[model samples]
Target: MLNIADTLHRWCREERPFALATVVKVRGSAPLPVGTSVAVDEDGNAVGSISGGCVEGAVYELCRQVLDDRGAPQRARFGYSDDDAFAVGLTCGGELDVLVQRVDPGTRPYLATALADVVEGRPAAVAQVVEGPEELLGGMLCVDAAGGIRHGPLTGVLRREVGAQAWSLLRAGRTARAEVGGDAETCPERLSVLVHVHASRPRMLIFGAVDFAAALSQAGRFLGYQVTVCDARPVFATAARFPHADEIVVDWPHRYLEQAEVDTRTAVCVLTHDAKFDIPLLRLALGLPVGYVGAMGSRRTHDERLRLLSEAGVPEGQLARLRSPIGLDLGARTPEETAISITAEIVSRTNRATGLPLSALAGPIHAGTSS
Candidate 1:
């Protein structure tokens, strides 16, 4: 996918006319988060997506019209309601307000900066929410590399402190809430700054460097992971076999993870099932904050490994974190199929989604809150 903001900035800088479709507000089971944007140039070439695929066609038609009309920012709202309202709304039963605007002077500069940060992988995307006066709730902001704030509207001590807090959320690539009401009071609409953080992609530290490791490394890259395969056996750890991996290190697994470090953003998959290789590495991996830790093995093999881990004093809490049977219960029989199931589980776990279908579930399709 193209950088939606970058595409807009190019059109603006080239003195060419273009239109941008941005998600301004969302209520009731929205698919894409608010502030999602895409640019359609005068020639009808478009970049980025707004909904899963629902609203883009309509949003594009609106863009073609806006290219000729020059004025202040224009806003459009889209929603789904069983109760008839507008003729146009999402059929998925969610409400979203889309702000489509000409790439005019008003937003050209601000959008340019925002897209610059995103294209360069600068870690966050934030926007200002210009809602009316005293009802002039502050706005949103995001974090940067040095843990600094990018967008800000709140003022004084609270502003300064919350900016720092907002950066923390951005670093983790999550949306968060921060109180912007000057006093210790909390307001429902107190600058509900939706901090959009771009957590660095998870690092795949593949141990063993075997045929399975090679396949898993490729699979990891396909899934947008920064794959790194490492093994102390230099013969097996050659870069030729794993061209897709970002780093192929001939290093010990335990020492490599210890030094390179793994956070909640990292994913460690132990492909080397040999006890001498997998055990010590498992000991180190279990202690880290990685989101997904999967080790390839049969149920019988995993049980043995678990017993050994318990004997090694690896603590029940930490031991419980490992996905021993590795992937989900997909009954995968091949390396390719197994890799898919494993990665699917990892993605589902990262987004806090169960391995269940939306149709089977009862209420709304959100990870946490219900309306």
Candidate 2:
């Protein structure tokens, strides 16, 4: 899987054979969503995880069976029951549908390419036929951001249809299952494919090389974001100050944001707390369709900033998108705590969460719109 891209690349370079077990479908309170995978080598070495540790042992055995049999990929389902709490079921009372397939250096050459693209931060997607004819089981199709099929097995109408579906999922940064072929009423044996989007790391643009920026950069990296720290002052925006940041740009915040590539997954954190930078930069950020746009400041500063933004012709709706005071009400007093608060707010916003404690929630802790 893309999560273990580095390890997968190493295995490919070493010509090592491995079995990949992917969670293609999940139900109930599953810990991981579809597309999460774990790889086990012939030597019993493992990388990644499909479950949080509940069904891993059984999945590992399934991986070994795939390598030993050298046959068509197999699917296994694991779930929790009232009587099977201590068995191979998830402690969280969830269910998982796992697909185990052996991958060899000679047979799956596209895997190496996919792993490389993931490591290099390129957008890609892996489309696998999880349910189909025995011979087609585990068959793979790979596509990149440019609508190019790096490798695949389908052809003609089927290929085009599947590629279009994969491209759509890739752009949305979502993993999902798609059905192809004739209508159920007219024909049977419809193909079921899982499109696993390997999107590049989401961007986190932190405008201001302050202490909070340094901590936020580290937190962003930990959360798998490509963090950029920007400031107009060259002395403040140095690599030494924000080592975890992917880039340190010494430029005006508004100018840089105008030229930066931001998507629905991107998060912008305005930590400069200066009117000159915050006013102009926020005007642009609020108008863009980014995932999050938060500015750090006190209550008084927030009111002043809003007044200036309103006077600058920013629409009321766009101004409402700004999360002034930046983070959640965690009563954070230190840079590290503030960074955690900010990242937590970003996560909550992106996931459409209520920012409530798990204990207070009645449903699954990781609940979200299923894909």
Candidate 3:
């Protein structure tokens, strides 16, 4: 499958006409979650994003003109680091780069197919940006869930194998990078693939629409989760309350879990303190392949919940999957702080980490650069 970059290239070649936006660099806290992308078509149409509505407008204009000129791919950059952003009228003041190119239909047939596949739920594609002009720009592999590697302008058996590994990652809804070992004596530098895994955007199913849930949804969005909030009361589940949430469902907690698709990449968090809502939801959450299942309460509440579940025929082994007292022991007192603790726990699970502080631990936080 064609990675996002290659897909744009291929589409442009086909004369379909699209824009390409890329995160070139990030500094400080950063507005855009890096690797965020946005594109536009010839008729001032767009898909994806570069920043939080900051530079996307100007970038789209460039794309509109660039689509008409298929001479060569052009790279456009915007950033807070530059004095130029004020002139462009970007409020967020974040840094971004956009590549506007006309795609080749014949050469990028695979990319076009991959783009279609993603929209149709054929699974994501992994792509490798190898031998590019700069450091972060080169040898980069972006793997979709299925692990198919999209290697650009690079060829050989290694490319095939690595691309296949990328494909596997894409299909699996995981991200990974592969480095080719064998190289000729003349070519000393082994192919170093900077693997960037793009799984299906994680689903954050939040079971409460309380104040805490808003912060929790924001935290989840920061982690790239497609956030959703559930509250049986329609009054609470309004767009005004959860501005960050991608979705808000007013339905029974357990029913929502049963009806909505839950997968391994999904996370379910129960913020409601009420036993009436949480217990049923917990039962449903434990049954799925979801990566994380957490419920908010105290140690006493946790014990009581366990006792109730035991009475309901849930075994101890199954009950162990529930994070009853929910969140790491971060000594968080407020809803926002508590939200951070919960999200931290989710990251621990995602990275398969032990949830220890860097001061207490040693070695790299990231497990491997390429896998």
Candidate 4:
């Protein structure tokens, strides 16, 4: 898991043996996603979480069993059923497929490199045999963004196939299980491998140094975003104003955005509330393939800004991408509440959610990866 990479890497460096339980698959309204993990040592110490404290006790015991047996990795299923809803069942009414395996650096050296990549925010993926023969259990293959195989034991066709699958998952920024070696004419025994992708944190560029930007910076950091606060005025863009921002730039917003590396996962928040900065920055941001672009202003200010941009020759299609008077309606008045509303809007947009109350909904509380 990305959250526990540092702790796991430390355990590996200390040569301490431990058991790692990963949520390989989930059904219905699961608490965590597919790549969530929990690590437990022999002394009953634990790191990370698999179900946000819903099914952790059961998974922890399962980890203990794997550590005690020192055998092939085991798969455990936890769910909520009417017959056993109160017996180690998830309150979220979801099913989780967990794979527990021993992490011994002496045997699985590739884990160290994978953990390092995760800790250092390098794009990488780890492919592990989740279901196969005893001899193949715990077998791992790691691939980085540069098409480099850091460590792997598989060779020939199988190695090539797994490497390609790992790369595909890395590009998709998802974790999934794939079936391998299922050609009945040649090899009848099929193997299931789980690929865990560790992509770099998404970027959140806040083009303002106002009080709202400081609160938004902290919120962005909490959501695992590499936040950057930029403004032309160096005196107002001091690090002390927004300590949570990953980067503070004393340059024009549009100029900084022109040189920034933004992807489909990146988000741009224009809190400048000024036409001079907003027009130029919104022009560049709306043309890019970023995930979100929102500007903060009153309705009157937004209308005037739109008219200015229209006069500047920005197309109507590009103008539609700008979310002026940004953030959802939550009756927010304070800076912290406003930050929460803005971040909530970003999360809902990224997840394709309706930003509706869960009690009013009927389907899964947590959106699926495909959603």
Candidate 5:
């Protein structure tokens, strides 16, 4: 799994055989999402986690069994049990369908190639046959960012179909499952393939090196963002001040952002409250195709900011995209609390969530994904 890519890559380099248990499907409120995995080395050591703590012991034992059985692949289903309180299952009342497969460099060469791509920050995806014919059970297909198949077993139309799906998943940076085959040329029956997307972490560009920015940088990094704190003042934007930031750039915020490679997955936070710094940076960030563009200020400052940007020729629609208050209404006053609120808003906007508590909703607790 990409979450533990570094550990897995290390194991591969050592030529150590291990069993990987990945959550391929979930039926209900799972704490962790699909593609979360737990790996166990041949020496009875383990790394990574499937569930936060719910069914790890069971999955670890499953990994041990796979190693003892000489790298045989297996499937396991875990759910809450009403009969036995000590049963190995999820306490959150969810079901996890786990696929345990052995990764041996001598046999599965594609595992190494896929893990290498992930560790090196190259966009890639590994399509594993989760449910299908007996012989094709644990087959894997590795696809790169350019829709090129680095390794796989399927050929002809089936290979093309799987490769296309893998490319789609990689572009979206999502780990999902798709059904392929069920044709004369491909396969008579439908086969389910779990595409484990290994995309680089998205970028979180925070302008202004204030205390709030420092707290936000730490929160963004925890949320899996490659955070960069940029400012025009070199005195404030130092590594010692923002130790959690991946990068600290002492440049004009707008000038630095003009050349940044931003995409729909990037989040641009304008924390500089000054009129000179805020106006130009927001003018550019608002027009760009980014996931979120938020600014920090009071109600009066927010109104003035909107007027300035409107006068600067920014469209009304684009101005609406700016989250002037920068965070949800969490009544937060401290820097750390504000950081939590800001990152919460970013996640809610990214996931298209309602920002409402689960108690107010009636459906599934966790968001649904293709499986």
Candidate 6:
């Protein structure tokens, strides 16, 4: 489990065996999404959780059973029981398919290597066979960002196909299932693989050295973003100014962004109200494939910035991507509050949320499992 990677890695290094119960699939109303896991050691010590509280006891007992017997990997399903209220199930009315498996260096040598990558902050994904032949039940393969297969089986065409799928899911930072039928030449079995991805932290590039940028850096870090604060002024872009930023660049905003490694998950925030910095930086950011691009300014400033960008030959579609007069309609005043507003907008956009109050909407609070 990437969430408790440090603890798992520690156990692996100590040669302490543990049984892991991971939620491989969810049907509806689940408290946690796929890849949520709970690991139990031989001494009855546990780490992590599969359900918030609903089906934890059942899952823990399953883990203990696996540990006690040193048994083969097994899958258990849990859901609400209408007839029996006291049944061992999820009262939340969701269905979870959990895979319980034992882990140790001797049995799964690849696990230690995969855990090392996760703990060291590298992008990695563990593809485990959730449904397949008995022999391949717990087989796992590790795929890194570079498309290298660090460990596990499925050779030849099967390996290439699974690796490509794992890489795609890893890039999207999604833990999902992939099905593969019998490849006549490579293999002859229908399998369901659960790809548990541990993608690197997304980037949050704050293009300014103002107080707002400082506050935003902290908020971005809190949201698991690799925050970088950049400005042309050396004094303002120092580490002392942006203590929470993972990187502080003293280069021109546009220049630094031009060489920055931006992906679809990256968020670019132009906090510099100055046209000299904002215009050039936005011109480059809007055209890139970054997730969110917002600028801090007033209504008049936003209009002026748009006109300037149009004059600079920015396409209308690209200009439409800009979120000027940034942040939601929250009447935030202080820098800290404004930072919350900005990060909230970034999260809302990323998650495709409506940014509305939950009470105002009518439906399941947790709709889809993407986020």
Q: Which is the leading candidate under TM-score?
A: 6
Model 4 agreement with the true structure over 233-306: per-residue lDDT tens digits:
99999999999999999999999999999988899999989888999889888999999999999999999999
User: What lDDT would candidate 4 get against the real structure?
Assistant: 0.87
Clashing residue pairs in all predictions, respectively, total 2, 0, 34, 0, 0, 0
Candidate 6 lDDT over residue span 1-371, tens digit each: 67688889889888899998888888767788888889999999999987888888988898999988887998999989999999988877878889999887566667788889999988889888888888878778888878788657566777777787788899898778898767686458988888989998899999989999989999999999999999999988899888899999999999999999989899999998999999999999999999999999999999999999999999999999998899998999999999999999999999788899878986555576622
Per-residue lDDT of candidate 2, residues 180-290 (tens digit):
766544224678899988887799999999999999999999999999999999989999999999999999999999999999999999999999999999999999989
Better of 1 and 3 by lDDT: 1
Point out the higher-scoring one by lDDT: 2 or 3. Answer: 2
Q: Write the per-residue lDDT of candidate 5 for residues 229-298, one digit (tens) a residue.
A: 9999999999999999999999999999999988889999988889999999999999999999999999
Which candidate has the highest lDDT of all?
Answer: 5
Find the 10 residues in a row with the least total lDDT in model 3: 134-143
lDDT of 5: 0.89
- Residue pairs with colliding backbones in model 5 are none
Q: What is the lDDT, from 0 to 100, of the residue 371 in candidate 6?
A: 24
Error of 5 at 12 (Å): 3.4
lDDT of 1 at 282: 95
In order, what lDDT does every prediction score? Answer: 0.70, 0.88, 0.67, 0.87, 0.89, 0.87
Cα RMSD of all models vs. native, in order, equals 4.0, 2.7, 8.8, 3.0, 2.9, 2.1
TM-score winner, 3 or 5: 5
Looking at model 1, the pairs that clash are: 133-136, 173-197
Question: Which of the two, 1 or 2, has more TM-score?
Answer: 2
Task: Provide the lDDT at 255 for model 1.
Answer: 80
